[model samples]
Each structure stands twice: as C-alpha cells, then as structure tokens.
Target: MTDQTKIRSGGRAARRAARAAPLPDHMRPVRAGLTGGAYRPLTADGMDRIHAAVLDALEQIGLADAPPSGVAYLTGAGASLGTDGRLRFPRTLIEDTIARANRSITLMGRDPAHDMELSGARVHYGTAGAAVHLVEVDGRTYRECGVQDLHDAARIADTLDNIHFLQRPMVCRDISDNLEMDLNTIYACCSGTTKHVGVSFTDPSYVAQAAEMLHMIAGGEDKWRARPFISNSNCFVVPPMKFATESCLVMEECIRHGIPVLLLSAGMAGATAPSTVAGAIVQALAECLAGLVYVNAVQPGHPAIFGTWPFGLDLRSGAMTGGSGEQALLTAGCAQMHKYYDLPGGAAAGIADSKLPDMQAGWEQMCSNVTAGLSGLNMVYEAAGMHASLLGFCHESLILGDDLIGQALRCVRGIEVTEETLALDQMRAVCMGGPGHYLGTEQTLGRMETDHVYPRLGDRTSPKEWSELGKPDLLAKATARKAEILSRRSAAAFDPALDKALRERFVIHLPR
Candidate 1:
C-alpha cells in the first residue's frame, strides 16, 4: 500500500480503539442527583420580596377549612382561630416551624443503593402523576389505565437510569373500592421497582393497614423504619387557602406512623391561585408552611418535602399548561424558595401538553426538564413519559424520556473548566507538533463517554448511513426497547411465600 494509505489506515484504527465501549454507570456523562442551580430566575431581592409576601399571606388571610385535629394542632402551635373561621398562623410560629423543619432527609429505596439524599441544591428526577389515560405510542390513541398498567409503568421506570424514583403515576381505574385502590397502588409500585416509591392514601384509617403491608415488604416495621422506601404525597391543602380535610387527616396519619410526608400544594395559576406568577408562588408557600407548622407541632423536625407545585393555566381558556414556560418559571422559583428555607423540596416539571410524544412534546418536555435542573430543584417529578397535560402516560415515551433526561442532566453538569479541564497544554501539543485535529487524541478518546452523553434511542448517523440502515424510526425503536426491558426484567418482584401472604391479606388486584 502507498504511505498515505498506510497513515490513513493507522489513524482510523486509533480512532476506533479510542471510541471504545460506553462508560460504566458511575463514569457516565450524566446520572441522577447531579448538582443543578446554574440558572437563577429570581434575584435575591425578588426572592426576599416573594418570601415576605408569603409570610404576610399566611399571617393575614391564612387558610380556612382546617380539620378539627388540624385546628387543634395549629392553635396549640400559636396559631389563632379567627372569628372568620380562618386559622391565622402567627409570624413567630411560622418562622419557628421553618427553623425546626427537617432541612436534610434521605428518601430510601427498597434497595438501599437507590436511596436519594435530598439537601441543598442536589437534584433528582423521577416519574409521578395521577394520569388516568394511556397514550398508546404505536396506535397513537388513548385508553383508561388499569391496575396492570400502573405496575408495568413502575417496571418500565425500574430499568431506566435517569428515572431515579417511582411515584404512583397512574390511577388504577379497575379497582372499585377506595381502600383496595390505595393498597393496590402501593403494592403495584413496590412490586414493580425497588426504587423509592411515592404513594398517596385516600383516608386516614388506611395508613396503618398500608403501613403493615409495607412492614411485611420491608421484612418488618423496624427494618422499614430504618429504610422507609415510601413517602406520602399528600395534597394537604386545597387551593385558594383551604385545607383538604381528608388529606390533612391522611398527612397526620402519615407523620404519626413515621412515614415521610410531601406537603404538596398544587394550585393552578389564574384559576385556583392568583393569575400572576409571583402571586401563585406566594399562595403555595403559605399553604406549605402551614403544613410544616402542623407537622412540627405534631412531631418536631418530622421529614416533610416542601412541595410547591404551582401549574400554569391558559388565562384565556382556563386550561392546564404543564409544559408552558410559565410552569418552568414557577417550579424554578419554588426551588429557590426551598433554598431560602434550607429544606428538602420538590416540584413538578417535564409534563408535555401534547397528546403524543412528538415535536411539540419534545420542546415542552425539554424546556422544563432543562430549566428545573439548572434551577437546582431537589426533586423534579413528572420529568418523563407524561403526555396530554398529565392525563396520559406512554411506555415508549418513557423510554425515550430517559434519553431526554440524560441530555438535560448533562446540561445541568454544564462545563467544568478547571486546570486539567482547560486543556491548555494538550491544545499546545496538538497545535505545535501533533495532528491538526483531536479525533484520535488521547484526551479526546478518554472523554468520549465521560464528557459526552450518547443517546440509545436517538439517531446520530449521517443521512447516507441512516438510509443505509433503512431509515430508523424513533417510536419503533422506543417500542422495541420497552418490550426488551419488560421481557428481560429479572424475576417476579417478590418470592412465593411473601407473595402468597400479601395476596391472602389484601385483595391483591394484580394476578401472578
């Protein structure tokens, strides 16, 4: 061969060798719990002003419709019952509650390895919703989600790397009884994934029974307490400054039973909450702080996630726009407020307004996911696979969302320009004497997988190569991945003995 041909062949060989296998989980370009907060939507003064308004809202208007027990708790903690029937929280009481609130807490997984430590600006993304419908990716249609769908959703999330935890996403429409539905929700999520699961209970009395089942799954109450894998996603307050009586009772039961509570205040802007973005945030904070006060009064420093999920509404039509830029701002602003209080916090993001996982969904999902990460959100829920404004969940979209979240996390990682990373010496070497390009360089090769994230479902080939590969279909690829993951998932989630016992005890809706 000619000398030129020999040199080209050697370069190609080195490039191939350098671009080796994908990095291990630890060495991947992006993973769960990466630091966010690169974006600051609210300045220090803006944050302070909003916080001051929040304090004023609680002290003045406060919240109505507190449960009798909740009233006692609030009154006992320096809150006053107004003649107008509003339970007004004193400034001192609210500040004291914030002081005593649990700033850091570990959200344990069924397997300890998946446990998430939430504090400061650490970020975690996971699935969460009450979507009642399924957006079939292949058929491009919708259907009511059943009990099995919820279980399958958890199973799908289990195999995904970027999806860090499982929150009961779908409502099991097949289950008729409320108690049975609650138990089945817990069972389905716990049985499908070992990741930390978030669940919601309908009534206060159901908690003990559910706790017993969780105890069984965790080997015993002691072990469960040691590493509680579940948390109560309680919508403790109704929007417009009112306490949800039943949910407040449930929250009380959750705190009493040693279950961590997520004090979720989901107020729709321009509808349930004030139309202005800042106003929405003020209301969310007021309600959640009331919950914090209640939890502290019941038991000092109880684990509670400050959940301030204020969704945007199309003021013209009064429709929920979970994917709107306003939604992203609201969530990011709430994250800053969480930072202001130094509490473990969570908010909703990554919901697609589109009915399907198409281009619209792409733009919508990425906008919030990226902003949430950059805003340093502690936990970003509904960050994948949700469609139809959270009315539908798709398996294929979820698989594809894993890729989307991977890219967003890489963005959150941003660019690290340290002494070693600056690459000044390497640049000089290449420019002065080495090859004119970096394609086959040692540093470039080493960073192939470490510095760059590769997508499994996304195409990265030239047009000629793509056509040669028969014009790959993104949806079809996601479908095949979903099937492979579900089929290859190892073992039934529980052993026969434990499985049979659980079945006999509760009306287990899911068949083996």
Candidate 2:
C-alpha cells in the first residue's frame, strides 16, 4: 500500500477512537437543562399583550364548572365565586400566586441521577400523551395498545440517551375497568424505567390506592414525599376557559398526597380555543394560571408545571394539526409566556401529523421539537414515538426520534463564542503554517466528541460506500435497534420480591 493509503487508514482509526471515547457529563454536546430562550416567537410587546389578555380573561370572563372543592380552593385564595357559579380571579391574587410560586423545582427520578432541575430556560424532552393504538413496525397496521406495550415503550425510552422521562404515552385498551387500567399504567411505567414517570387517574378516589402503591414502591410515604418520582398529568381544565370537574378533584387529591401536578390546559386552535395563535396562547395561559392559584391555595408553593399545550388545527378539515408550523409557533409562543412569568413550564411538540414514520414524519417531528427546545421549553412532552397526530405510538419511531432529538438538542446548545471556542489561534495555525484544512488539526480532534453529535440509526455514508455495503434503510435500522433494546431485561425493573408483592396487591396486567 502507498504511504498516502496508510495515512488515510490511520486517520480513520483515530476518528473512530475519538468518537468512541467517553465524555464527562459537563463536556457532552447536549444534555438536560441547557439554557434556551434564544428563539422568541413572541416579541416583548406581544407577550405583554398576551399576559394582559390572560388576566382579563381570568377576571372578566372567568372559568365556569369548577368542582365544589376547587371553588373552595380558589375562593380561599382571594378568588371570588360569581352568582353564576363561575370563578373570577382578582388581578392581585394572580400576581401574588405568581410571586409565591416555586420558581425552580427539582423533578426527582426513581434513580437520583436522573433528577431534572426545571428552572428558567432549562430544557428537557420526553414522551407523553394518551394514544389508544400501537402503530406496528409495518407502519400501516395498528393494534389496540395493551399494558405490555406501555411497559415495552417505557423500557425502550429508558435505554434512549435523549429521552429524559417517560409519561404514560398510551392507554391500556385491553383493560375493561378504568381503575384497573390506571393502576396498571402506573405499575408498568414505574417498573419499566427509573426515570421520572407521569401518570393520570380516572377518578379522585383512585388517588388513595395509587398513593399506597407509590408508598410501597418508595419503601414508605415519607420516602415518597421526600423525593416523589411520579407526577400527576392532571388535565384540570377542559379548555376554552372551563374546569374539568372530575380532573380538578384528582389534582386536589394528588396535591394532598404530595404528588407534583402538571396543570395541563390543552386548547386546540380554531376549535376548542380561538382560531388565532395569540388567542390560543392567551386562553391556555389563563387556564394554567388559574390552576396555579388552586395549587398554591392547597399548599403554598406546591410543585405544578405550567402546561400550556395549545395545539393547531387544519382549518378546512377541522382535524388536529399537531405537526404544522403554526403548531410550532403556538408551542414556542407559550414557552415565551412561561419565561415571561419565570415559571417552570411544559408544552406539546414533536408530534407527527403523518400516519407513519416516513419522510413526512421526520420533517414534522423535527420542526416542532427544534422550535420547542430552542424557545427554552422547560419540559418538552410528546417528543418521541407519537404519530397520526398522537393517536398512534410506535417503538421504532421512538428509537428514530432519539436520533432526531439529538440533532435538535445540538441546535439548542447553539454556537459558543468564548475565547477558546473562537479558535483564532487554531485558525492561524492552520491557515498560516499547516495543512490548510481542519481535518486532522489538534483542536478538531479534541472537539470531535464534544462539538458534534453523531447519529446512531441515521446513515451518513458516501453513495459508493453505501452501494458497496448494501444501502441500509433508516426504518429497517430502527427496527433492528428496537428489537435489540427490548430483548434485554430492563435494569430499571423492580426487585423480584417487590414485583411479586406488587403483582399480588394490584392486578398488574403486565406479565411477569
């Protein structure tokens, strides 16, 4: 072989070694809680207007149909009940609640290492939503989601590097009983991953039984309260400025049991909410602020995520447009409001309007995920494995989404311009005295792992190389990876004795 051939082979080996090297958590290219308020879809004036509208909506219009207990919670906290039974928040009350709310809170994971510090523009991406069907790997077939599917999705999410948490993403359609389904959802998510899990209850009465299970898993109620890993994804509001009575009761119970709550206000644009983007954000913010008042009234500074999940709609069809650019703007705009209030907030993103994980799905998922992360959304939900506008969940799509989110996070990290990062000396070294390119420079080699994100399933090969190796399909690669991840016994699974006891106490539908 020629000397040039030897040099080329050696360079390739060095690059491989650099890519394989381990990075300290701080040095990694992307991670949870990277500051992101850089992309502001809403201007300062626009935000001021939205905030004013929110206050007006809460005070003048008010929210109707609050549960009896919710009425007490709000009224006790300076809110007044109208003769019409609608709850109106005093402007002073709203301002005071925001002043006393938890500005920064730690969302603990079952394993302490996975804890997320949600404050400011700190970003975390994870799975969420309640899809009823499982999209088969074939991309065309669908099946009703079972308890095992939920467990498998959690396990897959656990192994994914970019997915930060696992919320109950699908319903167990096989379970006929709502209470049983709720219990199994909790057991499946908790047992499948040590990461923070989010679940919802069908009724307020279910909270006591669920708390018992959580306490048992946590070794006691005290332990659970100290570092509560599970949070309640409570949809306390039914949207368009109204309370979901039963869900409000569940939120109350969860707060009483020391569980963190996601005060979700999912208003759809042009439908449940106003047609305009600004109007949608105003309504969502108003609803969540009311929830904040309720939570703080129950106990001062209870952990509640400002979940302003206003979605988009295809105006002509009246169907949900979860993947539209308008949807991205809505999520990003809501994130801006969260930052304006300096509150820990979450919103929906990474949803695919496409029915399958094809080209359409890729662009749609990346578009929203990028905007949401860049806008500094505190908790980015539905960031993976959602398709058909969140009606279907696919494991292969989730594996692929890990790769997609890795790239999105790199964008969120943005360009650093410190003295060392400016690289003037290195530029001088290469341009004046060296090889005239940055291929094998000392700085380039040093930053290979730290500055760049490498895809696990995405192929980046030359056409000739691809032809020689037999071109690989992205979906096919994801399928193989999904199989590999699910085949292994989850490290996060509960201890055998504990699992047996849990199975005996609660009718866990997931097979042992």
Candidate 3:
C-alpha cells in the first residue's frame, strides 16, 4: 500500500484500539488542585485579561539585542549573551517562540500505538539546558561522567515507552577544559531517543560542537541538520528568584541556531513572589512572557516552550518548597496562558520536598504529576528521580515515576463509546428470552478483550484467591514489578564504529 493508504489504515486501527481498550477505573476528568476548595475553569474575562497582559509584555519590555548566534540560544529569565566571558541564553528568542508555533506535537516513535501526546507538557529541569554533576558508582563516587554514562542513560530511556527525551547526565566535575564533555554528553544521551535533547547553549563553541556531534550521529551534516531535535537555553531572570545577562546571550545563540527555547521562570512564592497562588502565577507568567517577546522579535516562529516552576517558600527555613499547592496551581494557570498563545507549555511534575522515598514523597510527586497532566502541559519535566527540592536524583524514585506516568497516561485515555461496549445485541438477545442467559453466546467471547484492560498491578482476585497469594499493598506489587523490569533489562547495542566515534568526542582528561 502507498504511504497515504498506510496512514489512513493506521489511523482507523488506532481508533478501533482506543475503543477496544477498557476504561480506566478512575475515568473522571482530573481536577487541578488549587489552593482554594477546587479548580474553577478560567472565565472568558480571565482569559482575555491574560491575553492582553501577554501581548503587552511582548510589546513593551521587548527582547534584548544580541548576535544571531547568541539569539539562537535564548533561554528564560533575565539571561543574556556574553556574561563574565561565558556565553548566555537570550530572553528574546523564548518570548517570541511562545507567541507563535502550533504548541501541540505528538511524541511518537517506531510504534504509534505507544505514543503519548499531550496538549503541551512543561519542560524545565536544566538551568542551562543540561545539568552538570557527579555520579555515584557502587560505594565510591566519580568526579566526572564522560559520554559513557550519557549513552547508557539514553539507551535506558529508549527502551522505556514513557520517557520522551534524552537529557544530559548530571556531570559537573570540571567545566573549564571539558566544555566538549557537556556537548558530547547531550549528544550521546539524546542519540537513543526519538524525541529531542535538552542542552545548554551557554557556550557558543560548545553549541557548535554539539551541533556537529548530532550531525555525525545522523549519518552526515545534511540529515542531522534537517532532523527535528529539541534544545532549550535557560536564563535565570527572576536572582534568588530571575534571569540575568547570561540567559539573554544563550537565548540569542539558540535563536541563531533555530533551536527551541524555554522561558523557565522559577521563584518561591511568599519569598521571591507573593504568597497567593494566583499572584505567584502572574509573576511567573510575566517572567516567561518577557522571554517570549524577545524570541518573537528575533524570529516570530522560533519554536519555544512555556515553563513555569514557581513554588512556595518554607517560611521557617527560607527554602523553596517545591511541594506546595501553589506550585500545582502555577502549573495549571501557566498551561492556560500558553494554550491561549497556541504555544507549547512546560512545567515541573513528579517533584518532591522530601529527602527520601517516603509517603510524603509519593503523595507530593503524584499530586504534581497529576496536576501537570490535567492542566494539558505538553512537556512535563522531572519525570524521574528528583528529590530534596530537585537537588538529588534517586534510582528508586525513577522506577516509581515510571508507574506514576503510566497511571497518568491511562487517566488521559479518556472514555470510549462503542457497540461492543454497550452490548446492545447481547442485551436484546437475552431480554427477548426474559433475561435468561447471554453468558454462553459467541458474542460475549468475541468481545471480552474489547471490554477489559486486566491491569498488571491492580488486585482483582477473589477473597479465597487473595488469601492463597498473601495480601500485599499496591506498593509491594509495584516494587516487585520494578525488580522484574530490572531483571529483564538488556542494554542497547550500537554500531561499534559509531559508538567509538561518539566516545572519542569526549576526550578531556579528568584529575585522578
């Protein structure tokens, strides 16, 4: 069949599959938990006010001027190019991109059936588009994580259907000489996923290196340059709370390179911002819009993602309380504003204030992830292993996050209506005979799969059967499932030459 015919057939089959899939146990529309009693839909007036504010922000403040290359790397906050001799992200690229773009995109892979597309999910996580940190191996910790860890992480993400992008592994030991290390790190990590790679265009030279590395991986410069890859430069505009000149320069570089930008505005409500959730959201939106306008001025259609991670402050210790209800509300409100602009929105989900894997962590993470999902965020970041106000990453948290994301996706599947579901013919046949019996009908056997999901984790056994297996909590079952996945996990193999080439790119020596 021709490609067009194949697409049509595939679309039909997908619809049928969607209808056939059993509805999730929790099928009601998820409500965003605001500080008030419950979430109230945005009124027409509220939407208009937000729109006017965004437009005004775009026209008034306007983006800072920077070189085309610098504009290409624009990020959020007050980030600008050329700061202390280090490159920075431009705020303008981010502002402009948010003003335009389709905002919606399906994160599909080899199998469309496995795709999970959101209206827009918030994307943040990287301050400079990628994190630089040390890694723990066995009992000892390593100072630097070259490209090897990056590739490993990429391979793992590639195997999972839920994770969409490859983020640079936390590798912060030496930044001065090993600039290429970060670039290669992002490339290796992103090579495994079909989705985009988030990177920091803080260093223009490194940005060029990353672009070259991507070209090499895609089988030459032409294909690599043509492929769709997502990269955002971040600026911290709002200091204990915004972006500076550094952010503007990075954004400029991103604009020059035609890379997507994210205006990440993160401030602690009640500290950096007002205590009220609505007030915090407004401030965060203002910060993001400032960046958005800059990007639009440089290039109207530059791809951008709206990112708001405004949290509340722990008044006692003056720390950012990422688990506050205000954070969830900010996510939802930002999503509304982004939808108005038809721009992709991003926010934090699965983040916790807890120091470890405990009840607090579970609840906080669940609430945040659910809020983002319900708010129609296109790119929700921090999907796996964030802790202590997003200062640490844990393997167990990553495993738990996979389950959480699975549940969220199931929630978004919505409901379906079909002949098989209603069982009209079976009802008629049985009713005609005075409700005697339809259990033995062929129709029942043929449609059983269409009516049930048969969850792999939830309990459905009878009391007697449950007694035989020993009663266990859902957490225990989830733990067991994680063990099973780890046991069956196999590392992805790559072309030996390609792997060698990728590794060679990270040739900086570390202090022993």
Model 3 — TM-score against the truth? Answer: 0.70
lDDT of 1 at 494: 81
lDDT by residue (453-508, candidate 3, tens digit) is 34445567898888888876655665455456545423434356876776676553
lDDT score of model 2?
A: 0.93
For candidate 1, write residues 171-197 as lDDT tens digits: 999998999999999989988999999
User: Relative to the unseen true structure, what is the C-alpha lDDT of residue 408 in candidate 3, on a scale of 0 to 100?
Assistant: 62
For candidate 2, list the clashing residue pairs, or say none: none
- What TM-scores do the predictions have? 0.96, 0.96, 0.70
- Candidate 2, 222-327: lDDT as tens digits: 9999999999999999988999999999999999999999999999898899999999999999999999999988888889999999999999999999999999
Instruction: Compute the lDDT of residue 74 as modeled in candidate 3.
Output: 43
Which sections of candidate 1 miss by over 4 Å? 1-26, 490-492
Judging by lDDT, tell me the better candidate of 1 and 3. Answer: 1
Q: How do these models rank on lDDT, best leading?
A: 2, 1, 3
lDDT for model 1 comes to 0.91
Error of 2 at 235 (Å): 0.7
Q: Which ten residues in a row have the lowest lDDT in candidate 2?
A: 14-23
Cα error, candidate 3, residue 266 (Å): 2.3
Q: Which residue ranges in model 3 land beyond 4 Å of their true spot?
A: 1-41, 53-152, 168-178, 191-194, 239-243, 418-493, 508-512
- Pick the TM-score winner: 2
Q: Which regions of candidate 2 deviate over 4 angstroms?
A: 1-19
